[model samples]
Target: MEFGYHHSSFATHDDRSPAAALVDRAQRLEDDGFEWLSLMDHLWQLPFHGHRDEAFVECYSGLSAVAAVTDEITLSALVTCVHYRNPVYLAKVVSSLDALSEGRAVLGIGAGWYEDEYDAMDMEFPPADERIRQLRDAIQLCETVWTEDSPASYDGEYYDVDDLYLNPKPDDIPVLVGGGGEQLTLRLTAEYADWWNLPGVTPEEYDHKLSVLREHCENAGRDYDEIETTVTIPTIIRDDTDAAHEVYEDLLEETDEDTTPRDEFRGLIGTPAEVAAGIEEYQALDVDRFQIGVPKNDPETIDRFVDDVMGEF
Candidate 1:
């Protein structure tokens, strides 16, 4: 399976600036056989992952800068929140990035979550059902904007556009929908997305979702094999499993309690060999790609994972 690096943390030392650091990391990832580099699209960090008040970078702008620095790795947001920007405007942003990257751009998107971010930004946070509806409309609108000639008009339940004109359109830009709602989300994925991202689900759960997705694809009269399957999980890799657990513990908040076998962890946290085994389990379920969110800005874990785990796969 191809490996993708998700930039979930923003940590920089005195030796380099954040922008320089990202460039270096991006180059290293490309050299190390990572196929894609995705950045978190949220305006503020999520509390479950990091401090909400911590440093955060805008997604598309950062992607443009990264496109200038790296040539091989495809650049995208881990999953852009659909509610944050107008559907047509998002198409414009992604098309601009695709042009900048010379067609090395993919759009990973989802219905908006993290109500706190929306409230903080004074943006409306609709109910989950409504949000998903908007996501569906946005996907349709994006396709219209990207593929159709300009001066178009689209009227959907949630998103309506008049005389929508998009120039410098991307050449068949791929959309990867991120979510695993067995009903609406999976149906939408089967109907609209080029890729389906399952975040933090176990191998068994992933297998079940694949089944559900296939059923949706059949109902929609679409080929299930056409949609690439990807899974994103936080990975902590070290030379020793115990050392990795120590790092995991350190990363936990004060109120969090440690559990045996790291039950508190939702993703792989162990030595390179152990992590490779975990990936093999997922591979057995027919997962096509893995996007790992390595906490902090620790480059050593990424290097170790590539040298040890990725080589085995």
Candidate 2:
């Protein structure tokens, strides 16, 4: 499975110097043999345990900066909230980024979350059902912008665009959708998505959801395995098991969570051999790509895992 990394707004190393911190992280990702580097999209930061107060950079511009420096990695908004922008304009932004990145772009999108973002910005954040409706419309709008020739138009229930011309439509940039909701979301994935992103589910849940996705694709006359499965593997890897435990210990203290089995919750931890075993086990379950959200954003820790674990992988 191809391994990737995710950025965390929860904490920045040294201080709140987000610019320097992200550049540093990008450099490490390039050096660490990671195939893709994803940045989380957030308008309003949600602090789980008072770790960080607010979001640092706008996700679009942040991705631009990330694309500017990294030459070989796949880059994307880990999942842009659909309600944040009109889908056609969002496609333009993505197309421009893809041109800048020389075609190493993937679109990761999801229904909007964080009510505070909606409330603060005064954008209409509809209820869950309606938001999904908008998400579907947004996906369609993006497709119209990317694939249609001449000026394309759409009049969906939530989105309405008239005679739009995207002169420089991107070349074959794959669209990825986040979430494992079985009804509308999964059905959309089966119909249109090139990739599927899921989170916070057990292995049994994963199996069941994949089964459902396969069933949906069969009914929709689509091949199930054609959609690449990219999973977010939350993890903390260290050269030594004790070092890993120490990181988890610090996390538990910082978050005031129970320490028992904390490493398991964080994801594949332990020595390089043990970590490799865990990753291989997941690979057996048909996960082709993994976005590993590393806990410590330190250079040394990142380098260690890259050398000792990722190299082995």
lDDT of 1 by residue, 219-240 (tens): 9999999999999987888888
Local accuracy of candidate 2 as per-residue lDDT tens digits, 1-313: 8988877553575774777678767876887778887877776443432233444667778778888888898888879989777687888898888998899888899987778778877887788778778888888888777888869788888788888888677878888988888887888889888988886455566778888889889989999889998887656667787887787567545542355465345566577787777777667779878777665454555666677777666
In candidate 1, the residue pairs with backbone N, CA or C atoms under 3 Å apart (3 or more residues apart, or in different chains) clash, namely: none
Give candidate 2 regions above 4 Å deviation.
Answer: 10-16, 49-55, 239-243, 252-264
Q: Could you tell me the TM-score of candidate 1?
A: 0.94
lDDT (Cα) of model 2: 0.76
TM-scores, one per candidate: 0.94, 0.89
Best by TM-score: 1
The candidate maximizing lDDT is 1
List where candidate 1 sits over 4 angstroms from the true fold: 254-261
Cα RMSD of all models vs. native, in order, equals 2.1, 2.6
